[model samples]
Target: MKGEPRLAELIASLSLATDLGLGLPQEHVLRQTVIAMRLAEAAGLDHAAQADTFYVSLLAWVGCIADSHELSRWFGDDRQIRADSYQVDKVGLPMMRLMLTHVGADAPPLRRITTIGRFLTGGFRDAVDGFVAHCQTTGDVADRLGMNARVKVALSQAFERWDGKGVPGTAGGEQIEAVMRVVQIADDAEVFCSTGGPDAAGVMLRSRRGSEFDPALVATCLAHSERIFSGLHEVDAWSLVIEACPDLDRPVRLAELDQMLEIFADYADLKSPWYLGHSRAVSALADAAAVEMSCSAADRALVRRAGLVHRLGATGVSTSIWNKPGRLSAAEQERVRQVPYFTERILSRQPTLAGIGSIAGMAFERSDGTGYPRGLRAAAIPVPARILAAAAAYQDLAEERPTRPALPFPQRRAALLADVDAGRLDAAAARAVLAAAGHAVGRRTRLVAGLTAREAEVLELLVRGLANKQIAARLSVTPRTVATHIEHVFTKTGVSTRGAAAMFALRHGLVDAGGTSAERPM
Candidate 1:
C-alpha cells in the first residue's frame, strides 16, 4: 500500500461528496476531517497514527448512505433525517423525540399510512440493523483498502456510545476508540458550525458533552471554541480543508484510487437499497457495450468512469421518495429529478472529476424534450452524455424498483427501442447499450477489439468516468495494468479524447443493455 494515493486525499474527496449528498456546503466533511486531525495531533498521536485518525474522521459516516433506503422508508426524506441526526444525540429522550417528529412528518396520507405500516411491521428493527450494517460495511471497506486494523475496528464501533445506548449498545470508555471519540465530536462540531455558526456549534457540543460526546473533548473544544472556528466562515472551505491535508509525499497510485472509488461507490449506493451495486453494474455493462459498439478507447474509458459514479446525486433525494412503493407525487418527482444536478454540483468541484460529472449530470435527460432538470432535446445533449444517459436509464429500468418489477429482456428491449424510435434515445447508442446488456439485435453480432473480458471491464469503467486508479481497484488489477489496458484500448479504438471515445461506443453497440448475455469475446 506504500506508493498508493494517500488515504487522506481520497477521504477528502469523499467528504466533499458526502457534503453534497447532505445538501450542505462543500468540504463540510473535509473541514471536520481537518479538525479531527488537529485534535488527534493535539491529543499527542504520532504522524503515522494521525494518518489513521485522518481517514477515520473523513470516513466516519462512509456507511451513512447504507441505510438511506430504510431511513427514507420511515421518514420520507433520508437526507433530512440524516441532517437531523446531527441535532440529536442517538439516545433516550432526544433520539426518541426526533424519530417521532420526523416519521411521516411531511408525507401525504397514503405515504403516511405506508410509513406507519412499515414501522409496525418491522421498520424499527430494520433501522437498527441498517445502522449496524453501515458500520460493518464501512469498516470492511477500510480493511479492503489496507487501513490499520485499529482504525477498521473503530469504524465498526463508530455508532457505539460511552453510555452504551448507540447502535450496537456496547457501552464503555474502552469500547470507544480515542480517534473515534475525537472525530465524533469534531464531526458534530463542524456540522453545527456550518449550519448555525460557532456559537450554535459550541452550544450543541456543550449540551451533549457527557451523553453523545466525550466530556474532556467537549471541555477542550469549548476552551478553544473561538480559535477553532474563527474565520472558518470566510474560508473557501474546500480549499482550506484540502490544502490542509496532512501532506503525504506520494500521489495515489491507480490501484489505490480504484479501491477508494469502489468503497465510495458502495457507500453512495447505500443511499437506497434499490441502488445497491447499481454504479458498478452500470460501469461494467457500459464498458462491454462500448467495446461492442466500437467506441474509441478513450471514450470507453470515460464511460466506465461515469458509470461508477453516475448516481452520486441519488444521495440528495429523500429516502421517502426513493423507497416509496407507489408513483411519486409531482413534487417528489421533481426532487428526484434534482439528483443528477446535485451529482454535477459535487463533481464540478474537483477538476480531475469534472469530465465524469458532465456526463453523469445528464443521466435523466431524454433524447426527446421530455426529460427533467433541464429538458434539452436531441442534438442539444453531447454524444458522450447521450451514451451515459442511455446506459443509466436502461440499467435502472432493468432493475426492480419499489413500484415496478424488473422488466423482462424482451419487454425491456422493446421499451428501449421505443425510446430510440421516438427520438428520445439515439438509435446507435441504444443499440450499443442493448448489445452491452447482452441483448441481440436483428442479424448484428456485438463486436469487441483485442481486449480481455477484464480489459473490457476496465474500458467500460473509464468511459463511465472513473480514473485509471479507480478502474484498477474495481477490476482487482494493478494501476499499471489499468493504464496499459487504456493504452491498448486507445490503439484499438482509434480515438484520443475521452468524449470522442465515448461517442464511438454509443455508435457501435459496445455498451451492455442491462440483461444477462454473453460478453463479447476478447
Candidate 2:
C-alpha cells in the first residue's frame, strides 16, 4: 500500500542476511551491496549507471540458492560448495576438482555412482550453465518490474567474465555493461573482505584484474579502497544500503512492486529444473483456496503474496537436501524447518508486509502443533495461516520431492484428509482445500461419533492434547467457545479424558500417529 516501488521494496527485502546455512548475521547481502555501490562510485561510473549497478550488486547473488539443489545433489552439502566457490578464481579447474572430490562425499556407493554418471552425462555442464540462466532470469524479472533497460542489461550479463569465460560468454570489457563490471568486482570484494578485510579485497581485485574483473574498475577500487570502505563496519548495512538506493527517476507503486516480487520469486524458483515453476504454482493454489474458502479479498491477496515468498526461506537450507535422492537425517530435517522462519525474518522488516509475513511464517505449521520452528497448537494458529499451510502442503505433495515421487491424486487426498482428521488441519478448511484441489466430496458416513465438520475438528484437537486456551488461540475463538466445543465432543464421543478422546479419534480415522495429532505438553 505504500507508494514505494516494489522493486525498491524487494531490494529492501533481499538485502537481509544470506541465510546460506551458516549462522551468519543478517544484512550480509546488504553489506555486500554497500561495498559494491561504493566501489562503483569510486570507479567513476555515471549517476545513471551507478544506480543500475547498485541494484545489480544487491541482487547479483540473489539467485545463488537456485543451483543449490544441484550443488547439494552432487556435493554432500550445498553450503560448503558455495563457501568453497568464493575461494576459487577460475571456474573450470576448481569446479572439476571440487566435483570429483564431492561426487560421493556423503552418499552410498551406488548413489554416488549414479551422481557421477549423471554428471559425466552433462549434468555438471548444465549445472554450470545454470549460472548464466540465473542472470538472465534475474534480469528478466527486473525488466518485468519496470526497471530501466540499462539495469536489466547489466543484470543479464552479471555472470560474464572479462576473458569471455562466463555464462553466455558473449560480453566482456567495454561490451559488458558497466554496472555488471562494477557488480562483479563488488561481489568478489565482499567475500574477500569477509575472509581478510578491505586489504584482502583490494588484493583480490588487483590479482584478478584484466582476467576475472575489469582492470580499470579494479584500479578505481584500489585507489579509493580505504575511503570507500571506511566505517563500513560501523553503520547498519541494511539501512545504509537502502538509504543509498539511487532515487529512481520516478517513484514505483505497490502494484508494480508486487509484480516485481512475483518475477523475482519466479526467477528464484527457476534455479533448478525441478523447481522451475514451483513458486507460481504454490501462489496460485494458495490464492485460489483462500478465495474458495470465502476469505476477504485482502486476506486472499495476502495469501497469494505470502505464497510468492514462502520459499524465500529456502535460501537458508542447503541445496544438497533439496536435491538429494535419499532420505534426510534429523539434522537435515531441522535445517529444512528453518526455511519458513527465514521467510518470516525477511518479510517481517516491512510493517505493511506483516500480515503476509505472518502467513508465510506459518506455512509449515500444522493444526496439531507438529510443524517445525514452532509447534503452535490449533487455537494458537490463524485461519489464514491454516489455509496457507494446507495449500503449501498440498502443493509440495503434488511436486516431486528429493526422496519421493509426486503423490497421486488419490494418495494426496487421503493424506490431506488424514491430516484433517488427525487434528492437524481444520475440517471446514480441509473440505474447502479438497475442493480447491479438484477432489469430489461425495456423501460419506461421519468418521468420528457422527461429529459435524466443525465438531470433528474440535474433537481432533482435543485428542491432540491442545488445552482450551491454545485451541481457542488457533481457531481464533475464545477459550469458552473451545471449552464448549470440547464438552460437546466429550458428550458426543463418550470420552472422559483427553487420552480416551485421542484413542477414539486415532482408531476411527480421526488422527495420525506422528504424535503430530497431540499437542506438546505446555
Candidate 3:
C-alpha cells in the first residue's frame, strides 16, 4: 500500500472476487492455481507454460461475469449453477439436465414452466452463445491487462473439453491448449479434493481422464495426487500464490494501478446489466466532488479508487436478487446488505487494495447511525468516505434499476438533499456532489412554468407521485414547507391535482428522458 503495488497483489486480490462469483470457498481459485503450478512442474511444462497455467487457473472462471445476466435468466442462481457444475462433466445429456432442472428454478410454477419451454426451443442456443462470449470476454480481459498472447490464447480455450463436447465444440483431444488442460484438472481437483479429500480428487481425475481431462495430465496428477495436494489446506494459499507470480517486475506504477482499479470496477459492474457503469459513475462523481470540496490529492485518490471498487462485493450476491423487479424478501435484503462486507473482504486480501476497501466498505454507511454491515455513525466516517457515500448515493439514483426508471437530474439532486436532511449524508458532501454533477448549488435559479427552483424541485418529486411528507424528506424541508412549495407550483403552473401537475411537467419537458448529464468516467 505504501509503494507501487505488484501485479501479483492485484491479481491475487481479484481472485477473491472470482471465488465469490464461482460460489466456491474463499481461496478456491488460489488453491486451484497452486495445483496448476504443481501440475505444470510435474508435467514438464516449460517455465513460460507454467506461468500461463498459473494465470489461466486464476482467470478460468472470470468470464462468468460477462454472461451472468443471461445465466440468471436461464438458471436461477448463476453462482449455484457454477458451484454445482463441478459435479459432472458438463456435456451431452448431463448438461441438458442441468439446464432443464435449473431454468427458472426459483420462479413461480407457471413462470418456470414457460422458461423451460422457451429454453428447450431456442434458449439453449443462446446459452451456448453466452459461453462463446465468456471465452471472448476472458481473453479480452487478459489482453487488456497486458497478459502475453500465450495466456490469452490458453484462457480462450477455457470451455474446451477432452471429448469435444464443450461450448463451441471446435477443439478437442490435444487440440485444446496444453496449459488449459493442466488448469482443467487443477480446477476440478481443487473442488473435488476440497469437498471429498485427495482420494475423491483422484477418483474424479481418473474417471474423467480422456473425456473431460487430458489423459496424460490426469495420469500425472493422479500419480502424485497426495504430493500435489499436500499442505494445500495448511498453507496460506494467498501468500503462496503471491510468491508464485512469475515476473520479477511485478509492481504496477500509479497509472497502471488506476487502470487495474477501473478494470475491477468493470468486473463488478458486469455482474448485472443494470449496473454496467455504476462503479465508474460513482468514481467519477466522487473524484469530481472531492475536487469541488477542496480535498487533498491523496484523499481524492483514495475516494476515487474506493468508488471504483465499491461494488466488488456485488459478485457475491445472486443476479436474481440484483435483477428482481419486485420487492425483495427479508432474507434477500439481508443478502444484499452483505455485498459491501464481501467487497471489503475481497479487497482486504491484498495490501495495495485494503485501504480502498476500507473506504469502499462504508458505501452504505449513513450519517446518522443507520447503515449496514457495521453501521458507523457520522463522526465515525471520514471526509473521503463521506464524499464517496454521497457520490454513490447520487449516481445510483442516476441509473435505472429493475424496480424503477432512472431519476431525472433534478430529482437526483433532491434525493441527495433529502438524505442530507435525514442525517444520512453530509450536507457539504451532498452539495459538492450536486455541483460536480452540473447543478448550480446555493443559488436561487429560476425555472420553467414561472416556478422557483424550490418549487420546481417539489414539483418534480410530486409528478413522480410522492406524498407531501415524502417530498419534504427528499428535499430536507418540513412537510409545511413542501406544502407551501406545492401550492406555489400549482399557482404558477395553473394545475391543482397531482395528475394535472404531472401532465404539465411532462409537457414542459421538465423530466429528463436521458439519464445523467455528466460524462462517464474514463
For all predicted structures, in order, the TM-scores are: 0.76, 0.75, 0.84
lDDT of each: 0.69, 0.68, 0.81
| Model 1, span 1-522: residue lDDT tens | 443344555566666667765656667777787678667766676776676777787777766665565566577677776777777877776776787677887778888777777675786676677677567556655665667777787787788876667878776565688888888888888888887898898899888888788888778877777666777767676665566665442466653454456555555665654555577777776777778778888677777777777777777677666667777889888888887787777667665566767877776788788886789887888766778777877888887666777788788789989898888888888888898777534433355766566656665566444567766777778999988888887787665433334333433444433322222111
Clashing pairs in 3: 418-474
Candidate 1, residue 241: the lDDT equals 55
Model 2 over residues 1-522: C-alpha lDDT tens digits?
A: 453444555666765534343224466667677877888777777888778877777666665554454455567676676666666675688767766766767778888888788788876775665575456445544545567777777777867889788777888778998788877877777777876889898877877899888898888888888877777768877667667778773455655545655654554453333454466667767777887899998788878888777777776766556655667789888888888888788877666555677888888888888886798977987887788788878777776554566778888889888988899887766676778878423333256566777777777566444567877777788998888888888788765444345434533555422212233222
Candidate 2 displacement at residue 276 in angstroms: 4.2
- Per lDDT, the best of the predicted structures is 3
Worst 10 residues of 1 by lDDT: 513-522
| lDDT of model number 1 | 0.69
Give the better candidate number (1 or 2) by TM-score: 1
Error of model 1, residue 152, in angstroms = 1.3
| Winning model by TM-score | 3
Q: Is candidate 2 or candidate 3 better by TM-score?
A: 3
What's model 2's lDDT at 188?
72
Off by over 4 Å in 2: 1-6, 15-26, 65-70, 91-95, 108-124, 249-252, 256-258, 271-276, 408-410, 439-522
